[model samples]
Target: MKQCLHFLHTALFARAEELLAKRIIDGDPLAYFLQGQLYFEEGWYDEALAQFEKIKEMDFQALYQLGVMYYDGLGTKEDPEKGVEYMKIIINSNSPKARHLKYAAAYNLGRSYFEGCGVKHSDKEAERLWIIAADHGNPKASVKAQSTLGMFYSTSNPKDLKKAFFWHSEACGNGSLESQGILGVMYLYGQGIRQNTKAALECLKEAAERGNIYAQGHLVEYYYKRKFYTKAAAFARRIAENDNIDMLAKITDCLPVYIAKGVAMATFYLARCLQLGVGIQQDQAAAKNYYSRVSVSLQVHSVLLLVLPIDWINKFVSICRR
Candidate 1:
């Protein structure tokens, strides 16, 4: 059973998958869960949905999986209302089987509220639900909630920089890659803490090497502002050149939207350098082309949320004002 569970996550093991499927034929509940997981991971959403729906009443994990699939419209039409109800079932369950899943469910529920999915948009309720999930912050699964709380506090109107710093600090310590990169940003800018260039550089450099796009974005800005035009342009060009919408969609599907801000930032800086010919070879036509992509966004549930943070608006405004 353990091997089969591991195989569900490792696509290289076809034999183990066959074994798990065989077990499913015998009505093994655990096999069903593992099978659903395998299908979900492989992007076989419709099959995964069918498997999960069958055992959702008995398996907390299946219920949670169903909630996520329905909410996200994975292999099915969007049904945020049904998704929320499934999550609520897991949250309200008194069964010990639900103990390990409640925190994650709460976090997802908080995101639903925060994003106004199947629920009224309520920062107050979102904050409340997230706090519950964040309290279980020691677990790997809990780290996402911790990191999201930081993002929420940092960007929401009437922002709480202090709390944002605290939550980000907590999430970073809990091993959230996103939070680790954001820590660099906050330290560099003194968002809610004392400015520490040395600490900021260390954090950003380490996170950037680990592929934290947020850190990479800020690193580009850091280089550009310091007149390290060559290094800045080089870094930004790498990200800008790989502008595949499908790839970005896959990334944003799993990561927070703000990560797109990093792509936007990198692209914007690269475009600026090209326009000014301050770094590398300047190409006016190339500069204009890149500028056009900085404000791009992705559509979700009929709303075009700026996954790209198309934050170029802020940058363009800064440029205009100058």
Candidate 2:
């Protein structure tokens, strides 16, 4: 790990990648997985696919990862049908640990079906698969299931409020900050759970402390709603200080959304540099130009989050103003 950090800091990308490949070839499934990730990051789709495929031979999660890539054309041509085929193999396998893969497969299959991405649309089929996936312990699927169930309940279908609450709570407890933040909002507004500001505050605080932007925004909103300016400012300061790049730079993917996030973050730091006249003169015009370019790039990439969090917006605003 220390060697890897040194390589990254020294920007020896090629050597680092070569070393990673060596590790992969040395019979390390994790190394193979990471090599695949590195290739994906470098946009060497074919190479990435090859590495992931090798890992798939021994790792079920690797299989699922490949299935996702294939489905989204991350490192290969978009082939939802083929993706579904691979998922089906995992879903039908009798391996004990394959249950989680099965759930993931089912969820992906349903997503493909629902979006007609690589299959025909079928709401009924999607709902069925979502239920199966949720039952198999897929936290994401569980949240979706609750959402769909909530929609159903609005039409006088027996509203499984308790079940929805349970699933959302479970997903939150399982480390899904989106779930935590959403559940926090629901509790705060009495959408599903009992109206309990205290519970909402606790949930949002947990998510924010863990570096979840969604949770941070919710925390801000919670504080604002309750006129807690001091708390809001303190959390905002935390946001300003957190080393987002340290965490993000560790990810080795060139996904458009992720790339956009990186660009945005980098632009923000550059702005900070200019504001403080660090490593350069304080040229507000140049700083603004950089931010503008990132904004345009982000817009072109369509990474504005089909569902953006408020904290994200706040971050954007703060950086832009600086």
Candidate 3:
């Protein structure tokens, strides 16, 4: 016990010295980025911005990170204008890294226009920009554009189900978890597609395997609905065990897409596991935390149900009616 305590003390003090040395490290762009990250985490936005700005030659990733900070109010005040300014500079550059940033820039600019954030609202213009981004292979933008196209064609004078399917397919093929999850929903609901439980499960499984947390959360239900109780319980264990924050962010960021439709399924699976203590160590507190998130989602969904369009209601009703 004394040896263990001594080792812990030495480890702690060594870490402190290492941190101090890191703070004094100079002439390193990566170090500046690291410092900027530390400052941002501490809410010292101005100091973080200064560190980021001291880089002698900004790489594409640095430019992208700076844009994100500007947009997210991380190391600077939220400024879509400045964010897009940096984005445009990289977008016009010939660097290979700039290609992805170019698509991201177009997507952000389109969103700004669509939401009238320091710009005018123009659906046509928004679609144009989204198409440009999608064409350039931005997975996020492709998902957005495809989903938008699906919605547009879903309710129009001359509904083009094929067009909707094409866009959704494109987005799904490009590895957009959002698109994969949505395509699963469309298949489950027979929206511009046949209702195939097997196909829907396949889509969800693919997305889930790709670290789409939302899909992982939703897959719990699809497995359950098929009476694959063991599979459902195992899936919950996998998600709870996953340590990757980026994958978690995929689920956390677009949580509504899954929570709105998958909460009941997740709750059911979670309850089954907690009651049986299957695979995971039984923890009521953990189960309650997940339930609480589902509850909040329920409340938001209830509010959204009030404003849902008639056509959307009809479509859902049609699925239920089947």
Candidate topping lDDT: 1
Per-candidate TM-score against the hidden true structure:
0.83, 0.58, 0.59
C-alpha RMSD values across all candidates:
5.2, 8.9, 8.0
* Predicted candidate 3 versus true structure: per-residue lDDT over 105-195, tens digit per residue: 7767677667776467876777677777777344555456655555455544577776676676787776556668767766876777878
Candidate 3, 173: how far from true, in Å? Answer: 2.6
Tens digit per residue, CA lDDT, model 1, 164-218: 9999888888777788888998999898999999999999998787667768888
Candidate 3, which ten residues in sequence have the lowest lDDT sum? Answer: 255-264
Model 2 TM-score (2 dp):
0.58
For lDDT, candidate 2 versus 3, the one ahead is 3
What is the descending lDDT order? 1, 3, 2
lDDT of 3 at 225: 60
Per-candidate clash tally: 0, 0, 0
- lDDT for position 2 in model 3: 100
**lDDT, candidates in the order shown:** 0.81, 0.62, 0.63
